[model samples]
Target: MDSYQENYQEEIEYLRKALAFIEEEVEKEAKNLEEKKSDLIAARKDMYENTIHASSDFESLVDINLHSMQINNYISSYNPQRFKNLKKMINSPYFGRFDFIEKGCSEKENIYIGLYNLMDRNTGRVYVYDWRAPISSIFYRYELGEVMYDTPAGISRGDVSLKRQYKIWNSKLKYFFDCSVRITDEILQEVLSQNTSAKMKNIIETIQKEQDIIIRDRDHELLIVQGTAGSGKTSIALHRIAFLLYEGLNSNLRSNEVVILSPNTVFSHYISSVLPELGEENVEQSVFDDLISEVFQGRFGEETRDMQLETLIHSRGKTSGEVRRQSIDFKGSRVFKQILDRLLWYYAHRLIPFEDVYYNGTILATRQQLKNRFLHNEIGIPMAKQLKIIETFLLKKVHPLQKKRLQRLEKIVEKSEGHEFEIKSFSRLLAIRQAVAFRERIRKFTIVDYRDLYMLLFKNHGLLLKLARGLTLPETNKEIILTTLQNLQKGQVHYEDYAPLLYLKLKIEGNDVVSGIKHVVIDEAQDYTPLQYEVFRILYNNATYTVLGDIRQTIEKTADGLLYDDISEILNKGKMIKLSLNKGYRSTCEINTFAQALLGEGTQQGYASIERHGEEPKVIPQETLEAMDRSIVEDIAKFTEQGYESIAVICKTQGEAEKVFGRLKKSVQLTLIKPRGGEVTKGPLVIPTYMAKGLEFDVVIGYDVSKENYVSDFDRQLLYITCTRALHRLVIYYKGDKSPLI
Candidate 1:
């Protein structure tokens, strides 16, 4: 037989053996688990029935303790996780394999890589190595040549004799490729050419060299990734979490200790399945707005970032929009951060009470003592905590004097002429009244609400001016302040104010750190302002961060979002490394080419397309809105018949999306994706551009690309985001003249 046929026969025999071994192991584990469960149940039953009266005697107590220990042992021994892993491996045990010969040894060993390690208990032989194993790094990082991998002992050098990748489904090898490169482009092209799905899948077998480097990096504490659209930033971040969990096996790192901050709820749902696919549980997922809402206990009405973007998009060129834009810019600026710092200083130095605290004409704590404690004793602490320290000190002083006074009154009452019982009752009532009065006095002086303090910045203009020294305020400063006060009065807060308000709250109320989170992943990092980064730094000071963003995809125009340099400066707690993923993999070359042109000149260098080609994006102009709608319906039908499952009709704003959905729902099956919360369903969908930030589809139809809708430079990113969501086809329909961006 030829070499190809010979290798195929060998692979088939190997698959049979692997399947048989997995089945046997699964049976063994199942038996062990059942025995352990029975032992635990019997032990518990015995302990409950016999130990009811064991506490009454020493010998009985000893028997009960023995039963308890037996139960604990049985419970700890009942592990069904291995059985589950074995069942998962029964169909497809491994995806890649390589034959390696050590530098000194003449013999070669075959290493099979899979989702989890598999071994033979009888012979102590490993059947497969987990993808995150140290030796598996060679499979991803090296070509067919001499390679070295780090082990617990040291570096081990070896030569790769053969490298092969397999695609096995239902215990059958569909195809296998013998590759001479790190990852064969044939496999990647095949994987990339498939249609889009509602949920993202794990890219384990086809991880590129650059992406594998990021996934396995353990040296840097802060990893910043600036990747273009379709560059697999989200995938890299998720795979990194799995690698960390595997590498930290002995260190007790858990899945729940890592948190991912996604763009929104739909995006969170979209990427939730990746970690579990890699044999790890999903980590904690949240958004910045959710964190803010949790901190405030949902007491205040807050505007969302998506809602703010929709307003800005819909109200372009209006006076109110300009005012709101200026307000957001000023609030998210460095000058505003400085102003907050000055305001904190003022609170520490000048906001203290100027009188001594006294009870019944006896001084408890002098004002100077309180000031000394607040300023000098509690150095480097939050002002709110410092005030708490002073309150505690004053209370300590009041307790002894109150006790002495009550003792003296009791003695006087005993010596007075009256019925003894009546006098005692009266004295007890008097003492209770005195105690209440004293506590009320202490409460009055020691309590300070941080909300009231924050409101002073807007209500007291003189204070704001004094704090804002040596800085240039925005031209609409007065209007901004007025708008803020009005929102506060109505129990509402603007989206841009969330960071500043939360930061100020942390400064005054002391940092409420979530100490358990060891790793934090911030997706779409370009959308966050500097102050928000600062807030994250303070809140998760102990966590290592992986921040991914692309500045070319920024759609928010109000806030001055932080770039890489600013982020490095703000979150610089340890060694930081920056990486870029320039290759676009989500869309075809034609789609990427058309989308890159929307970025204008200098920013187009951020991304390069792979060697995939498809139909070029088409911009179709119609005579009227009805005709445009009809054309869109026809195009959707054509794509659907062409086997495109996930199609999106992307609009500029939520209002526009609603109008389009209303007009098209009766004609076609449509699901409208709202800004706040919804599921991303397959098939044709109507969604706004901002809500479609981190999703992809097989076909995307831009609803209205008229100049009247997208009129400014700000809309370029929105249009680019809309077009880049397509994997195979992009169609733009406009009633009037096409947007200049197109």
Candidate 2:
């Protein structure tokens, strides 16, 4: 055998020996733990059955407590999972290896990098280094020369003599590489060429230098990452979470202290396997609507962001569409935020606007009296807290009259002649009791909903006009406000209004600041407006943020290019650091080249060239809808027969998705993706374009790309989003003339 092959065989044999030893120890520990559990259970039973004498009671309690703690220690020490992880490492011991000689040290240190650290049990020396460890940076961030890495104490400079990667699987060495300056393309091409599964894979094994920088960053309070369509933005964000968890183990932080706000629930599930594979527990996960429900206490039937996205994708040319877009943009802007702040400040001291409280034809309290009381006391507390104080003051005045008022109403009911009069008297008594109890409810916080506040402003156009002057709002916004009021009257909420409402709610009902959240990582963050960022800042007041998004993929009109700039100012002054991931890591060069054309010339500046190459996307013209459907079915069957597991047929609107699914399901078995769809499963799937954001598939079939379907710039954005989701193949089918953009 060759020299390298002989060396690899020796390493494999050593790993197998280590694996056998670990497995044996794990079994012994498991047996010990079971015996300890049985002993603890018996001791608890004895403690419950024994009746201690008064003289021995103190001694008995102490013994039981001490015994319970000792049992816990035994259980803690008997964890077999660490050995189980070591057993897993036997198959693929390490991916990269390097020799580093420290500045003052003589002997060279050989570091082997893997998913998790493994140690020599007898010698207490690290046998395999975790990819996230400080010493592992030499494998990813340096060439075969001088290198330095930072530690808790300070920087450690060294000379990297050798850098090599191994592709070991199932305890066999498939290949090995000697990297000179950068990683060879052979490994990346092999990894990327594999078929994508339902779960996202951890990128630790082949994370690029750009991605490594983002994952290891912890010094910045706010990190704004603007990447192109396939730049691995979401992947890098998850890695960052994993890094924080590893770093948190030695500090005051915990895994649960970080939160990830994804674009959709399916996207959350898609990325659920990444952190666990990296040896960390899952963090908090939610979408924007869930966050709104959390803050609003799930009152007043709030609309979800998915439904709003569907509306934007389907409604393009109508007047309703225009007004909706206007409302979203206007309400999501900084100018409107200033208007909301003004309204909140003006009403903080006078939140309780009741005119008077009347009991038995006598005025117990007047509006002027309550106003004076509120203005005179607690001048600077939150509106919610201030209202609590007012409630206490008003209750003190109304309690004595409640008994007299109820007695008078009962007498009136007894003296009534007709049944109707008696019923009216009972109603009056109920109203009196409710009036007295209203203050009590206020003490528990039942403030008016944001719908009420928004409707009130619309009812008084003069007040809105006055607020508009402060921001130089265009005159056209007057119509937008009217349309929004109409929607609110029908009990429907616009996406743009959700944030402003939360802001108003916090201003009046006090901020419901959730504690213990040290970091908030947001994916598809360009979709968020300044108003939403304001709400996030208040909710997690002490949190650092990591925002990842692509401006080219901004399908919502509510978001603009200045979103990151506006948010940076709120996170911290000069503390927010901006990073860019320009290279496309998720798609092939051919796919990226076609997707790049969908954006404007200047809009593609942030995008970088990809290394992968594949077949260029094709635009096929057909004569009828039936013909297009037949072609898609045939293609899906062909792709599936060719061993493709995960495929998607993307449609422009929910209506189109449903129609296509109805037809496709009759001919072939496929899953339909809804706005509130569950986890995306394996096999052929039908989905709407908007719901397909932040997700990818092995093969994608664009149902229709006709001019009739894609007419506006927004429609083009949706098309851009759908086309980039394909990893290997893309086919666009149209009924009429081909789209000019294609």
Candidate 3:
């Protein structure tokens, strides 16, 4: 214990010394700012003296030879090395002829000036602008905007164009640009454009700590970072991309090649300004929902309308239609692709060739006890002999059924028979021949009639309509109506089931819309199923992927089961990595302790982890549900009064959230925050626990903990999410039994 105390004392001493060193640095900065201020004054005075003796035309009157001789004499009189650059700089284009109108020169502000741009006389190309020299002050503030930053030995003010257009060579590339700039977003009559002031405190002379670290680590393909809400995680991510690009230099990576999967449209808007601030163009940004919709376009009406986001807003539940769910699951995962393969096999064996017999409320097919349509005996023979079977069937089917009426129907059946060569021996030949003949017999088609096959599609139109709504049914009266209506139609378009590669042919032979991106990042990765990931893989084939999410936060029932099992399976097993962020940096120390206590041993799961500190967690036992609602209202008002940025009454499900929100909204008049839940508005917000996953509040009041609501495993995630949202404080109020999670 004595040694520990000594170590603590030593740590205090070290911190004290560090503080002193920082103070000394601050003093040095102050001294440097003063020196710069004096230099500005000297330059202004010298310019005033030159103006008094100036010539109307610079080259004709003021002797450049005399100025150079004076600068040379000063250089010889003093240390030649000390004033070399300054001497050369003083004789610049508008050479020491300008004076700053030193009105607003105050503490910490150093004003200076220099020659502006050096343009090629013949080519009119800008060679350089002394933007970094101590001469850019006139362009920064509103004080000296009227005068051109440089002077040609005169005191007369000059007008400068807001934009200067030019073409120049940057390395091997020839670039043209219009460089227009606003200093403080204002326009003046005679705006100055030369040099400006540099405040010492704001001067960044060295790379920042995080920037240095990011620049050095260039090899890691995947970077998993969990940081505090304001800890610059996003800032670093953008910079990391920029640094990789700068290093990629002449290599392959370009600004267009980088992709950032933002959380939402509003979030994309929020981050849109960051990259441009770093002097790099913004990369492609989108939500995972966009990719999902693109993948299921023709087959399903899958929307990036996030199920969780919808549930929160629409007061929904886990989808109740089992068949509909099966369809969604099939399409949303690679399993759907496999199911397509299976269906193709079914089509190949003619298992899908069912005929409606009005049995079991669905169309049914029955197999004949004998060959009712007859069969070609040469079917099982070798390929060479099989050709003979097709040839014989075609010759027989295509033969003039009636030699007298052969002209109209002759070539049609003959041509169709050749198209159905295998079908003739396959028993369906007679049915196809009859369906085709009946079509031609009914319609005046000296043309080829492809209507018989379309009969089945038109008959199933009702089912197709319902399917488009993402619905599945056992059987419906609409099917009968559809069949009756289809029977009345003479000719309709039909789809032929082409073995296993029906829709797949369209996909495979489809044009690949190349997305120009080298890297794709999915922020909430666990919410994606294996199929969504595959679609992303296909869409951005040339891009490396970086996926990030807390699987515990994967509260969507339709997500990767929150087990992340699909991602694990699809990523070739161990190619998938699992990370446990044991330390929670978001909440307060007290809140962290209570939450860990609430979570118990389950908190140790790889999917669920939180920092060790936050506002204290509480359980307020109320008198009744109404009283609980009232208590939350009072607490929310109190939090807002205390300057808490966000306050939410988080509940397990959307239904529960709505009930609580409805009651408390009336009692407390709390603001009903829309999906655009910005910084805590004027009042508290009522939000679903799931919707509040990546959000936080100054205080969160758990609405209830009844046995039916809070103790169930289904509510465990909601509880975790709400508990983690307390940036400063959290309170859980319940009327009945305690929550299991609590």
Candidate 4:
């Protein structure tokens, strides 16, 4: 056998022995855990039955506290995650191995790399190192030659003598590769050839060098990853979160400290299992719509992003179309964000005119006194808190007025000619009580609505012009601003206005930065405007950001459709690092080639290199809608017969998706995916292109791919995104002339 094969056999033998040893340790630990679990349950039951009564004895309190501490320690010690880690490593001890010699060292050190580290108990030596270790960088980065890796101490210069990859399954070696340069397609091809499931797979074993750089980036405050479709950007992002958690063990960062903002609810659910599969807990996952809904908290009728896109798409030929588009663009820009900030600063200092509070036709507190208290008092605190101070001051002034009013009521009750003295006295006292309660109720100010606050800023043009001193804002039309304000007042904010409104709210009510999130991962970042980034800055100003998206997949156009460069400008310009992933592994070679054609030339840098090959996509031209529907249903049957379980019939809008589903649901069992459809099932799905932004299917049928439907640049991107969702088969049906972009 060759030297490579021999080494592979030796490694397999070592892993087998390791697995045998791990099995024994697992059994021992399991038995011990069971015993401790019984003791823990008994202790908990005893504590529950014997409640600690309130006592004055300090000694008894100390004894109870110590007893609780001891029980907690025993409970904490019973955690068998170490044994669980060994159990996980038994099937595959390691996926990579590297031989390296430090600059001054004469002997080479052999390092095996895995998801988690494993140690030799007898020798106190590390048998396997975690993939995120500094020394393990050589395995993914360097060839069998001179190499270097960064460490906490400094950069370590080394020479890589060997680089190897292994595929171990169930403690058996399936295959192995000894590479001289980089990891070859022989391994990646096999990995990509597998069938994709409903959930995203953990790609720790198959991360490429380009992806490794993105995953291990530590210095940049804003790390923007602009990758092509199916470039494993999302997977690399999840792995980066795992790496951060692994590296930050000594620091304050934890798994829950990281948050992931996905494009949609379905996309969030699709990638929910990725972190857990990588042996890390799942981070917080949410979409922009959900976050907005959460921030607004039902105060406004929030519109889903898909619904906004629908309005923008169908607004053609309408007179208000151009105005609406201009309004969306204006609201999403940094200039508008600046306007809101200036408005907040202006409002913070100037106290608005307050209404006088009166009781028994007498002024309890004049408006001038309240205004003086609001304007001349503390200026740095939040408006809500300032309002509270004003409320307290007014209440204090009312206390003296309340006393005087009660005395007068008592005098009138005693002197008045009433039938019964007790009844008259009680009636007068109740009137005094009601008047005092009314004064108290008036002093309690209602909260300012976000929508109203946003509109108030937009309506004041003179203040807006003053705020636009250092900034260049486009000439604003009075009509458009009024229309926008009218929409806001009606609780129907445009998609672009949502972020700015939230940002204004954050500014007025001090953004509580004590929310312990340390990192935020925004997927499908092309849809995020600078205003939204500003909102993130206020919400998580201290947190690191990982923004991942493909410009070609951006569905919203009127709102800030940011490319990588635009995003860099919006974030810290020089402090941000931009990375690109050009290799696409989600779809087959044939499918990617067809999709790339839609972008035409000048899109070479974003072109993805497909690893797997499949049948060329079939384009069918039908004369009528009925014919197209029949063809799609028949094709779905054929694909199902061919063992394709996951199939999607993609349309341009929800309306089209509903129409197709109404016809197809009778013939097949399928799910019509909506924006709030939290899960993407394994069977057939009828979905709009925008809703299917971050999901994939084994087979895809373009319900309609006509030029009339996909005429704009954003429409073409939607087409490209939906077409690339197919892994094995892709079929497009158009009623009329095909789109020129396609």
Q: TM-score, each model?
A: 0.93, 0.88, 0.47, 0.87
lDDT of each: 0.84, 0.77, 0.45, 0.77
Could you give candidate 2's per-residue lDDT for residues 688-709 as a string of tens digits? Answer: 8888889899899998899888
* TM value for model 3: 0.47
List where candidate 1 sits over 4 angstroms from the true fold: 53-76, 400-434, 558-562
Per-residue error for 454 in candidate 1, Å, reads 1.6
Tell me the alpha-carbon RMSD of every candidate: 4.2, 4.9, 22.7, 4.7
lDDT score for residue 142 of model 1: 94
Error of 1 at 269 (Å): 0.6
Model 4 CA deviation exceeding 4 Å by range: 1-5, 48-56, 78-80, 346-351, 354-379, 394-449, 457-479, 488-492, 512-514, 558-575, 606-608
**Whole-model lDDT, candidate 1?**
0.84
Candidate 2 residue pairs in clash (backbone atoms < 3 Å): none
Better of 2 and 3 by lDDT: 2
Per-residue lDDT over 1-742 for candidate 1, one digit per residue giving the tens place of the 0 to 100 score: 9999999999999888888899888888998898888888888888888776536788887888888788888877887778887888877899999999989999999999998899887898888999889899999999998999878788999999899999998889999999987878888898888888899988888888889889988889999998889999999999999999998876577998899999899899899889878777758998888888888876558678888897787768988788888887788777888898888778767875545777768887777877776678535777777667666666556665654564565565556535555555776656645655665565554666666776878888678878887899988888888998888778787898888888888888878746688889999988888788888888888888999998877776442234788888888857999999999999999999999888778667546787888998898999998998888889889999999999999999889899999999979988999877777888899999988988999999998899888868778888989988999999998877888777
Ranking by TM-score: 1, 2, 4, 3
The lDDT, on a scale of 0 to 1, for candidate 2 is 0.77
